[model samples]
Target chain A: MGGSSGMTITTARLLRAVTLVVLLIFLFRPETFEPMLALLVANNAPAIYNQGSLLSLTISHLAIAIAATAAAALISVGFAILVTRDFGREFLPLSRSVANIGQTFPPVAVLALAVPIVGFGTKPTLIALFLYALLPIFENALTGLTGLAPTVREAARGVGMTGFQRLLRVELPLAFPVILTGIRLAFVISLGTATIGSTVAAPTLGEVIIAGLLSSNTAFVLQGGIIVAALAVLSYDGLTALERLTARRTGRVATAV
Target chain B: MIASPRHKVLPALDKLGVFIAIGLLATLGFAPLMVFRANRIVLGETVDIAQAMPPGPMVVLLASIGVAGVAALLKTSAMMRLIASLAAIAVLAWVVGVSASFLVEGADAVARASPASGFWLLFGIFALMATDALTRMDPKPSLRIGLVLLAGLALAAFLASGIWDDLSVMREYENRAGSFAREARRHLFLAFGSLFMAALAGIPLGILCHQVRAVRGPVLSVLNIMQTVPSIALFGLLIAPLSWLSTELPILRAIGVSGIGAAPAFIALFFYSLLPVVANTVTGLAGIPANVSEAATGMGMTERQRLFSVKLPLAFPVILTGIRIVLVQNIGLATIAALIGGGGFGVFVFQGVGQTAMDLVLLGALPTVTLAFAAAVIMDALVDIMRPSGVQKGSQ
Candidate 1:
């Protein structure tokens, strides 16, 4: 607590800068992580960075993520809207419980169950990702749609907007930001999660990590992990930027800052 | 949106209920009853309703579905709905039992059988009906808990009745019956051990973040970033550091801290469990009103006294929630530790995946999921119970 205010250095800023530098080092020269990794791992692993092409793994990783996200977005938004509608209102608790159960049963379990019906490779991975992505996206959509400002609703109704028209013109626009936030979260989490796709013989960054683990190759593990982490961090940052823009447009509190 | 009122073909509660009932009955009448298999993993020999099992149990299941439909049409009480739902689960169990008895009794030692798509669909329909019934009833958590236990116990009793001795998953379990207990114990060890370590480290860090203005932002960001790091990658990342530590430090190796096995898995799980616990801790403390603490100060409370008396108690429920989340999540995540030879349920998961034996995988998965669900329910109930009288609305 001594001279805390007097110090010119901002700890948060300093930490962030240091973190960025470390991450950059990890990207360009993963071998540098070797000595540290070597000391920590059980085996005397030699420096061998970029075990596979990070570029390729990242592409496929993003590919799986994007596909999963797009599917999840469509289904979740539709389901949310359906459940929120008059005819479907009674299904809310059922939908909510189903979503909760999806989370309760781990995504890995979903992958296991999926493989039997779908077989190994991208299809099962996609299915698992789709299931894993549902809870967040659906919950957020419900929250956004249901948690509308009453005045906004009243205003839309007063303007002679039909139910569908009010939903499209007013409710959806207001809810878009929250929904976007959900998509963003799903995307980021899915990026990290899709690593497991490698276990099922789907091409992903996890292949490198798994390869590394099997051989006690710290450099390989670092190579795989750094990229995955970096991608997630970048995706998170990108989403935050979009979220802030949405917040500004909507005049809602900027949660992340 | 103005919903058009349709002519009443079925009563209000019975509209969806009756639909489900008819669908269930139709599927049963048309679809195969159960699948007969030579062994695990291969496509099963299909048996239609006439040959599948005795007409007795199938008839009972059919009767239950019909009754649920009729009950839905009537003005039913909570207790009535409960009975209807429980009856549905019971009948479903009996159907499964009868199918199992037929399959097991007919099969040889290596041969196995399981309920095929028709049976699974019947299960799905019944589950939906039961969910609808439960939702309508909206029983108290304790009552719901009791009902779940009762249903679970009934199912367990059926499984133990030796009627299901040849069901693929149980047969798989029987094969590894000795190792199953050991693996289960190891799984619990990993989950609890990591949780223990996480709490030991996280709480103090959370406290430090709360008390120290300088460290909060930096610490939280690091933890956040750590959280975003995927579980597998985190485990991978830990191997080298832990390996080096064990080798370089003889004393560490003496205590069995190596890079590959439980050590790295524990570290990874510990790191993953941190954010929730710490975030909750910080939130719980910050949520305490400044004026309340100021009042405590005016009343001659020391920092420790104010913290324990005001902050800690106020934060206890939230902290417990965080712990609960961590526990449930760890139970699920520990399955991955099997890949690293950490000896948890993931062992079966991987073996199943490798051998293409879905039953073996379920052997591991079902328990993990059940544990997660049980943990969540218990924690939720505990949180409700812990809430102070003024804060809690209902006296459960």
Candidate 2:
């Protein structure tokens, strides 16, 4: 019986494995020479380099993103601490409710409402990104802090550590790895959301693509898209590396259980 | 009966302050009209007739009545209070009959003056104050109250300001109506369709990946890669191939296949949906205890039976949760599809942005957001239904 189950599993995996390879091959393959060439030309180094406006816009987007991420992290960790403490159980449902509501309010709607008051540009975009990134960060921090073995916390308390001291030395240190994972997720999401800021004319990689779409310039669109994708991938991978390094350095890899 | 004098006085003062704050906010909200007068402007001018045509004192009187109604309701059931407040405001609105005037004036003003004038600074401050007052009332304030207050304020402001006189606002709506409808239909179709497709493709793959260690590494990596692709860029990447196909295939060309519409939008959204669906499915399936499957096998069940009856039933909730995530994400991302003409509410959004018409944009966006919220609520209900009753009981 086990053997048959194993075979079924293997067959399924093999099918997916093959399909994935085929997809990659298709994606990377140059299907149309002219379009591809056009895409390259539109995204050529000189045009991008000369576009000071685009470059500054991109910088501003990143700056705002960083600020938003920082805010999300602080709020999430604070909420996480509150929820994980003994006094926090009463507030768990409240925290979940907040997160649920946050998720439901689409960032675009937030942007629309904010534009009239904030008067466009980076501030509204930052607020939207911050709200959008809240749930994941909060969830991860809560789960990370709570998922720690009770015994470890108990041991810290038994040693005469105060509540704050216990949290800093034990709970936080242990939760850092999981919290980092959440940060990584939030970072990736924020990167994508920042592109939406382009609609408000806040400038980012999205400007190139939006311009391309409006003008029907396929090359410009593709080139801009490629760079954005590269940036996402680079950031995702970079965060993963940072997470792993932190995990290793803190020796949480061994104590994770 | 033996309450301290200080405590009694404090409650009275608190109530008094609430009333005062509400009144002050309402007065300040209408203060913008003091600077401007109602006057007609020729079409194509920057100054809108709406700005020129201020509401008469009658409208202001009605608004004050509405505000009083709202304040009174604040002490009772927040939900009932909100409804009462809204009813008062709506009644006031009908009494004033300024909506038509506002629309006409707003259009003229937008045509004549820069569209930005319609968005006065006081309008925002008033909205913020009203929202703050509503939210601060309770530990968990009624969403209904908040909505009613916002709608009441918006209607009151528009009527009072006389910003709606211009026919251009209506004309803009009508001109974009066809495109907007088409885009809306396209977005709804793609958002739901892509999610449905993701489930069909993702669940089986997830089951397989969980069962086979060898397949896990590559499958996970692919899923990760999909997740890492920023949404706009993903759509950008899709345009080239889809466009090529449109040209290469006669059927596609005849169908009016284009690079910037539904096809590319659907494709990009579909690709994005896969990662969450697949990841959730795998995680859910993998989490099922080993002994449960072992017992099913020992009972002489076939592999298919084991999956359907044993594994799937057990993993159903987790699978649904993944679907929930996909659905919510799709609703939000569907807006981006508007960038490519996939339509839905995004048509109004982008057009409004381009024209700088905040009202028209709000009309489109408010519904989109409401739809998303409704969708989320429905999905949450589904998950609740799918959850095993015993598990539900245990969780509680």
Candidate 3:
């Protein structure tokens, strides 16, 4: 923790606090920005999206993102753990390809395809988000588990730790930071992607943006974009800090995470 | 330690292969091979494989499935597994084509027949098995590149033969053949054009960041923040400003700049492309050995000469990797750009979604997947071929 520059941390915290305050104002009080929005658009165009509350839209957006990302993390991390074991090693190659190939799939296409099988609404969006979030978490978990020093494992064995005990106590702890980085990535991606759920009748911030687009209301578009971007940037910074703390605790040198 | 009796009794199984084979068998037995819709937007009825294909083609398909299954279950060599997998895929394609022809017989222009969940499942399983075999065999880089080209040729041939003309997605294509070509050209242009612009600006910025300690922190942080902004949001944010600019400035309007079109989308993609290119450039340059640079200095080469002749050459591969990442990323993002009238494959995707037509969605999606996959594979092979032999050896 001390290795990091104090000045950067201070500036980051300041930025975070400012963004939070501004977001709160935007969500709770649209009138504050309506004047500015009015200036941007013509007189006839609506300055704000009045059909849905911004706060509720933000909440629903977050709810879907969290649920999908949590589910993806659980399944993907479990699969990674399973395949790394001796009995499941034969599946390593297949699992790797599945994760890699899944990433190559565009999120928009995935969401679009899901509508055919599941029909429209939040169900398809959730399913798509889950599938989209799986790759990064799985890849990171596999890397974190497999990249353990062989000597560390031998040392644990020398100390008479059973396989389960060693895995629980040492492996999981050491891999936690890396796995958390994956979860952060997955969460950020899910947050952005869940905004597109509006196309399929899911109540999300995307509804605002899509509505704005259909009506050619630039104010509505800008408002939706601002809220979503704030959520992403703030959450990303918070997660990075958490990841760094965990890495420091585990004595792992953090690189770009 | 004595080995367990159960361990001795059980032969080691290729579990992934077995899993795929089981999925294949399950799909064959229970899932529908095709769907027949009375019209484009109607809910389709599932058609069984037995009802769709004639006995001769059915027998051939069954034989290929059996071969794939046997090769998967047995302790077969990689070559045998690869052959079985590819043959099974080919047979599956042929049978699907036959089934489409059979199903569409005497149907009106509005009628549609398309591969259902079962056919897709089989395709995915066989593709997985083939990939596994290829990975295990670890073919030479040149051979891998050749294989991708061969696959592309086979796809072209498949399309040219009109075997898939009766399929619903192909019908969607037939209806909009002109627009489909235009959108495809637009998609390629957006993807490649943005990449070219990004590389033009990014490489130099990357070098600047690497050389100047003061610029690195602020520049990278800004790029990181830009990256966190969703593509949709970025496009939206650009609309107001760009439109305002175009309205205020006649020169910009004359150049085709607009609020909610290609201009905003293009600019957003350029911003997204910068982080990867710049970061990779810095990394590649920083990776040069101190001794090598010192040697160049000792040879009395000017700073500019050392940079262009020595540092840039060493960093080329890594920079190329960054370009590959950006290209694949930009291709995927360009689809979303269609929402704001950027005009790419995404136009079909969003349109299909609005119309609730699955075939139209597939028509848009399948090509995007293929393009991204091909880009990744070609770039990977290029990276492998371009890497210095000594560096490759040392890394391994």
Q: Pick the candidate with the highest TM-score.
A: 3
lDDT of 1 by residue, B105-191 (tens): 846777776666677777666666666667776666677677657757876887778766757788899899999999999999989
Looking at model 3, give its docking quality level. acceptable
Model 2: lDDT equals: 0.64
Q: Which stretches of candidate 3 lie over 4 Å from their true place?
A: A1-7, B1-12, B248-251, B390-396
| Minimal lDDT window, size 10, model 2 chain B | B34-43
Residues forming the 10-long window of minimal summed lDDT in candidate 1 chain A: A1-10
Question: Top model by lDDT, which number?
Answer: 3
lDDT tens digits by residue: candidate 3, B114-165: 9999999999889988998988888887888899899999999999999888
Ranking by lDDT: 3, 1, 2
Residue B394 error for model 1, in Å?
A: 17
lDDT of each residue in A32-146, candidate 3, tens digit only:
9888889767857879888889899999999999999999999998998899888888778878877777877777788898898887889888987898889888988988899
Each model's lDDT comes to 0.77, 0.64, 0.85
DockQ of 3: 0.49
Please give, for residues B193-235, the per-residue lDDT of candidate 2 as tens digits: 9998888888888888888878876776666666655677677
How far off is residue A46 in model 1, in Å?
Answer: 8.0
Instruction: After the best TM-score superposition of candidate 1, give how far the Cα of residue B62 lies from its true spot, in angstroms.
Output: 1.8
TM-score between model 2 and native: 0.71
